[model samples]
Target: MDRLTLRLPPDLVRRFDAAAAGRGGRSRFLRRLMEEAAQAPLPAPVAATPAGRTGKLTLRLAEADLALLEAEAAVLGLSRTQWSVALIRRRLQRRPQLTPPEAVAFIEVQRELRRIGVNINQIARAMNTAVLEGTVLDLEVAQLAAFGDEIRAHLTGLRAAFEGNLAYWSDGT
Candidate 1:
């Protein structure tokens, strides 16, 4: 492959490096962007829309605030407007917007909780059958108690995680 070089302003390079960090660095990031751009269709010229179809919004933000917004949006691979709209929609809907990592953690926790619930259900069923048939219960009380404790711990952790997510979002970070 042929090599190409371009000179960029220092500040722009810094911003690009920051954005490209943890995303396979500058070269890979630029390559991916170029590939995406090559595959994307060109935008058509703007057309007039019905008056009631959409609304326009304008806001004046401080430089620091704009920088923060740009950084957050960059981290998520979103445009500033897209990120802002998503944040607004999530707030309006009373839903927490989780990052990819957060979503995966939540999914794993939920799966573990479901597995524990299934085990508890099995224990309960076995005990119920034993009681109905007037047979000795083979399960130990300590085992059931342990499961209960485990569930409580898991629930506590889940609650903490949810509260942390809420606080992080609400704090404008």
Candidate 2:
């Protein structure tokens, strides 16, 4: 690829030069900019790929704002650059508005899981009450225990569904 010279305003150039000195060489930063301009779409301000290294990409940010991004990134389980990438992706990506159909389905599933969990808990309580309050034959007790185990299996399935939904919406972040 041919290298092109970009004329920046004096202040911005000074900032970029200083930022480059803090991390690595200025050429590396320039190369990254060239790569991004080639790969990144004109509409979106962020890198299309998550964690596109832009530590040396100087944005005119207050030090406090930078610290806040770092803090938020730590909380979100990403580095500062990854967090910035996520912000960019959020801005540039034409977000798929959750379809009404999907929204309804998700809501229904959540409600059903809650209802089922409540029912399972209630049943467990009843079983406990039955065992503690009444003299239970071994066979009867075993049947109740088996039923409880079935309820537990169903709960596990609900948990799996919940996790799957979360992963599906996370968009590889």
User: How well does candidate 2 match the true structure, expressed as C-alpha RMSD?
Assistant: 14.5
User: Which residues of candidate 2, in runs, are more than 4 Å off?
Assistant: 1-136
| Each prediction's TM-score versus the true structure | 0.53, 0.27
* Distance from true location, Cα of 112 in model 1, Å: 0.6
Worst 10 residues of 2 by lDDT: 94-103
Quote the lDDT for 105 in model 1. Answer: 88
> Which residue pairs show collisions in model 2?
none
TM-score of 1: 0.53
> What is the C-alpha lDDT profile of model 1 across 51-144, one tens digit per residue?
7796767677999999999999888767888778767767787677776677888999899989988998888887767653323343445567
List ranges where model 1 is wrong by over 4 Å. 1-64, 73-82, 131-139, 171-173
Please give, for residues 1-173, the per-residue lDDT of candidate 2 as tens digits.
67677768999988899888855679988778777889976674664656754445657679999899889777656687766655655546633323345456667766776776677577667767775544555555566576667667766875676566455335576
Model 1: lDDT to the true structure: 0.81
